[model samples]
Target: METFKKGTQRLTDNEVDQLMKRQPHLLKQSYDQIPNLTPNSQEVISRQATINVGTIGHVAHGKSTLVRSVSTINTVRFRQERVRNITIRLGYANAKIFKCPKCPEPQCYQSFSSEKESNAQCELCKEVMTLVRHISFVDCPGHDILMSTMLTGAAVMDCALLIVAANMPCPQPQTQEHLVALVITKLKYVIVIQNKVDIIFRDQQAALRNYEEITRFIKGTIAEDSPIIPVSAQLKYNIDCVLQQICNFFPIPDRQLQVPPKMIIIRSFDVNKPGEKPENLHGGVVGGSILQGILSVGDEVEIRPGRQSKNGNQTTWHPITTRVVSLYAEQNELVYAVPGGLIGVGLLIDPSLTRNDNLVGCVLGFPKQLPELYRELEINYYLMVSVVGAQQQDGKTQKIAKIQQDEMLKFNVLSNETPGRVIEVREDKIMRVALNNPVCTGLQEKVAFSRRLSNKFRLIGWGIITDGKTITL
Candidate 1:
């Protein structure tokens, strides 16, 4: 122990030592391991689809059961006590687009056949199936209290699958919260899965009526016109329909970009074992969905949090390596993963050096576009009607400057949320905003612009920030 202690003392300075004392759970790396990117000649890149599905509603609503049914994997069973211990779990499944080989007519298999035999025969010579690899789905928890978790999963999603129990037609409190979150995330594509339909199957007419009532409630919401697929996870009824719907909703994505490395770190943790060498502790494991470009092992990346630097510098950047010891998509290993997919990358850094929330609003890239700073940005938002004057701990409502259309607001934007001033209002509807400080933002970046009224901050609405410069509205 003494020898180990002395060895560890050499790796981290007194500052890190003092920090680890308070957060003992972070003592993953003992003394020598920190991530370092080594240059390599072999680079493997793959194209994969990134799908995020959230199980939302009250407790015991079968959110977990629904995800387990679709993915055939049970995350809750493994760690029931800690559902959202990490921001998200990475899941992979196979997706394919087969060309009808047996079709008497060309391209007869374009539409999926209802019958199994006909589908297998392809109605043609022989169907050619392309194994679309790297389709990832993020199974999110649905508790109202776990809003943070839901939002995290919602942040990077192609679509959402909102699961609700059929017996309970009225949207639960958590369901409402999930709806709000989906709106805030600006996720347009969503499919409502009314699970546990067995309970209501006896009363089909009542069940249909209840379903219609719920649909009416969701009118004008993000789930507008979203097909409500009813299924009994326990009985496996309509499971195939759910699968087909997913494929139809989200087709295999095509390769879009080839330059720059854009990686989003989703999960990070320290792997610590008893009586183990401190250096063996697996350091920071940052995982994210790469939106564009490709990242390879031994690539040098700059980790930039959205916040400004302490020096008052508008931009901050950190160099880290692709010390990825293990890279998995969904649950399969890959030599290299590309954008358009979800992947959990194991970094070779001391997990203690970083925190999960730190990477929430961060971006990783090469020297090019290292520090992204934006001055003026235009955004579309929705007002939170319930976000009226909020009382503070002192029982006084916080003061919020009156925002007018065409006016520019000044404030800060962090982790997809904007807390800024109301500069100008235009046409009584649109308002312009100027951030107190600049952040690394981009076009179509989902942001929750908030305003402080009285003692509480209220979310105005969620939208993408377009045009980094000044906006007219």
Candidate 2:
């Protein structure tokens, strides 16, 4: 390492002032900031590992239950209930776990329900021991209404955990759709979870039949050879075995100087404080796992747009200066953050610097390229088209249109969601996507599109733009 001269040993006060020019909210006193760390300090403290995980399957398949059963959150709706309460249950939960929050008195009070049990149980040590050091689950919405959310969540996953009911052997029609969404993300690692094993205890033959059918359905799919662990999320049987397999299959990546300092903005928002200075419009905070890299205060960063370019074209990007005013890893703050851990960064920039009304999804890091846009793409899709529709080309009105179930299509990529014609229809494999308009794309960038149907945005498929060349409509 090179040494700095006496004059350059420290950054000037004006230099920091200039850096915080755009994001003054990050300078707040309460913001938990990560100070610069020495090389040795970064090596001593073991950073928690971060793995993006998503569940794919049909509705009511216990996709959400599996997550709630293992995380800090609990869906009270799923708990055994009486009809007297008359509460409609809509169960969906999302949670994050860091090295458990070490607290002396970790219990929070709860209201009495039936004039008894007035005290809230200690939530701290309750499942603290079960907390996976560096893993968090992206609780996915299972019903048809939430397929888009599921698909987007899967795009960022390092691995996909597919849950199949042990009682329901064959893949449901919706199961095929979920699989197609997973394929769009281009995620390679997958684990098939054979859930509700208790159903098979009474009827051995039925269980065996279901197993064979399920195996046959996924024989050539992404999870073909993945270990299928028979589990009961309700009964809590073989849960440890599932966790062990996950740990063994998806071991955490090492966190050291080797990793880069990067963070993806999965969530961003603004807040208001009473009796505060009016001039202080705090820059929004972005949250996501540090894919690779170290982040500290006073670093120059970039916020890249998530829009796809029209046609295959390269776009230029620039970096913005933002101080690490505050940092939270699994809800706890560290002096200096490390990689492989989930972090929420308080960026030092104007609130308007972000887009989409502060919606989370855009990525943040060192910006160099304009991220790229593409028009033409080749995708391997699972088309669940009806038999009648599949025979002819009058599919302009159907959900998946005139296509065979489990068929793949090549579709053109576009910026806004607009209806387009089929450029070229090919047999089961590679098909050319002829977009009605132009879109930009860069080499190796993954892009996704879906059908604009009435019920839901049925997932089409995602593919990397091969040739970064622009195409005119």
Candidate 3:
């Protein structure tokens, strides 16, 4: 409760208090102390963001711009990201949606930063605006090489915002790939943002044509019926409409708060600076979204497939067990964190172990309660008609061939990505894969498969884990 460190940003005791003072609901710093606490509990809602909205589309399509304009907080914090003018790693920002009861319809719905007072006042009626929804945007990289990074972000998404640049064609290469990815992950609720409308504002005919092209592009796809809203993220235009749709359409899913807590490690960091005293050196900080249950400070947690070492041709992974020292959602410290948005957990361990995302794709949960780790799996697989973004020699889409014996393919299950060789392809759509890097997964889990297209793996289809060879440690 005194201090916490995330990346290079450190908040002192008084500074932490100054940030937490706005949310009255976070009065107690204990998990059990909260009365009848749900994910929507006032204290939690006032302080924490519950919904995880993933912003995805082609590169330079304004995914980051849309998130920045709405959240007022830039997701691109990395120096490399700023220099490249694109998101390389997964970026995040939280915003609170407020609604004035007296104002008319969608006009009353507006989005503000997470730091905005929970009891926000409406600009129109001066009425106290109720906090309707608090959402966190998972700003995924849209670069072709960063497709794997985008899939990892898609794992925890409750819904998606598909950005389509009006200046570009309806379906760019990554746009199609990402849409198919949404289908592979079974993300059904989507909002299509036709961004860069300002570039086409002078031409009504061009705008209408672009809209029709978008409709045709999404036809027969998961986003066929998704509402397409024109917006200028650079100009901050029609942002309220996006907020209104999010509040109106996106339903709050039922969270598994009673189950044993499970969180997927997506980002990890060493927050210590050079020349810091040994006594003041802090442990690693793990950042991710909890899939189920609640996690609190002082809880002993285990990260599976944690540390890997190879010895004389035999490979083994050692699990790391550490006590939760602190829990954080952005700068706001919490007694306990619910299962949504990206949360950073401070662990009492050597920071070097978690440094530079060494723990990314690891699973964190109660000790000995997680699913088994698998080195080989038997999956019921299915391939799409053709690769979404690739063309063939005959001037048509490239159809995917059958998985060959001993072919190397990429698989993404949960937050982990591993390259696996086809060990056996049997009848009844059953295929066995020997993972290059073992992953911790359970029976009946869904995995997205990909192939090397021009030296980069492009998503082809998905499969279900029917059986697997588990590793006993």
Candidate 4:
């Protein structure tokens, strides 16, 4: 650590001022100005994304391909994902949306990759376009086995892009299930992307029939009014129209700056290379979007349900404490980060603790200000009418039954997942669960439930934390 800091120097006040003049998102201090910050504030969106837009649909429907077409990023980076040609983990990328104030209607809007200059010139107008929205794409896996992972991603989503294949019939298996996850998560804003239009382009009547099928599919769902944009992600056709629709349809959500800092960890890594010099080794880096409040450089933080220990048949969790060494949004460094785009927090801790996403799903905040660690939860549950993502039997979807005692279920709480068993049921609407691993959660946090069917877990219901059993530090 000393070697890593030996030649480096902190920026002077003049340097900070100069950088802020060019990159308005640098080294933000003072909480007093937070209340005045809007989603489109030049200081905010100019540097970092304030909206989390998720890409979701069935597997092989061009979800990742569409994101790559717009953002120029291939969200699938893992070895297995590349090998399997699927998104196994929740993938992320950032894009900046700019609009030419003088241009007409749809042609005015354009989306550039994260590294693009905030004030880029418009291609059509030849004038500087103003940055309107910077969004982080939470690319969720469409595989049935990763349904709970999708549910966890939904927790941070402000809006979603439902990518449906133009060639396939409406509502594929994971497509239906991902939509249901969005509904239960209460995500209101959605944009439906009819990708792979090139495949069905030659058949005009079939295309129209498929379009009508899409319209009917979303008739009563959350995306009922969402614009269905047809495009070929592979050929990058009509992608601008998709960008225009995104800018027009999705409204920036209300940001929370007055509350305590809350962040859900989706990915954590030890960025050090193999066999690096001891003096050059840095600490662990944790990445996720802030839920509320502000995180600053040098502030001390705590992670809940941290490390586990067992003593004589009793298990205990110890909260991990560390100080923030740096903050980042993608490759852009930030002195402070608020609730908005995904944030990467550098910590002064052992790299092993965060290597390979060891800290994923943990909640981070100011010490003693975080929520309780629950070993058991009492929730007011609502079971879905049918099991989602499960294959139909005898031409009928599998009906979800009531919560049964001793039956095991999968629960996703704030990006953290745990296997839970039904311990008790009351009034047929309330249930008690014993979690296999403790979770750090606040009261009334929405929890998505899945039950195993045909040897695979299917989304069965949802619940709210009415009460819980907590363990001592």
In terms of lDDT, which candidate is strongest?
Answer: 3
TM-score of 2: 0.62
Stretches of candidate 1 off by over 4 Å are 1-50, 54-60, 77-134, 183-186, 220-222, 306-325, 355-358, 370-381, 386-439, 450-459, 463-473
Q: Could you tell me the lDDT of residue 167 within candidate 3? A: 87
Residue 332 of model 1 has an lDDT of 45
Model 2 residue runs over 4 Å out of place are: 1-47, 74-133, 167-169, 198-204, 253-262, 271-282, 306-321, 335-341, 350-357, 367-441, 467-473
Q: How would you order the candidates by lDDT, starting with the best? A: 3, 4, 1, 2
lDDT of 4 at 334: 71
Of candidates 3 and 1, the better by lDDT: 3
Candidate 1: tens digits of C-alpha lDDT, residues 213-313: 67986798878788888888778777656665665674444443445666665555454555778756665666667766555444445665432344465
By TM-score, rank the candidates, best first.
4, 3, 1, 2
Say what the RMSD of model 4 is: 4.1
> What's the C-alpha lDDT at position 374 in model 4?
91
lDDT of 4 by residue, 83-122 (tens): 9999999899988888898998678888888778876999
Return the TM-score for candidate 4, rounded to 2 decimals.
Answer: 0.93
Instruction: Report RMSD (Å) for each prediction in the order shown.
Output: 12.3, 10.0, 4.5, 4.1
Residue-wise lDDT of candidate 3 within 1-473, one digit each (tens)? Answer: 74544222344577556545753346334334432577776678777888899999999999999998989989888899899999999998889899989998778888888878887899888899999888889999999888999999999899999999998878898999999989888988999999999998999889899899999999999899899999999998898899999988787777988778899988999999999999999999999998888786667889998888889999889999888878877777776788888889999999999999988889999889888899999999988888887787788998888888999999999889989999898877899999998788889988998999888888888999999999876
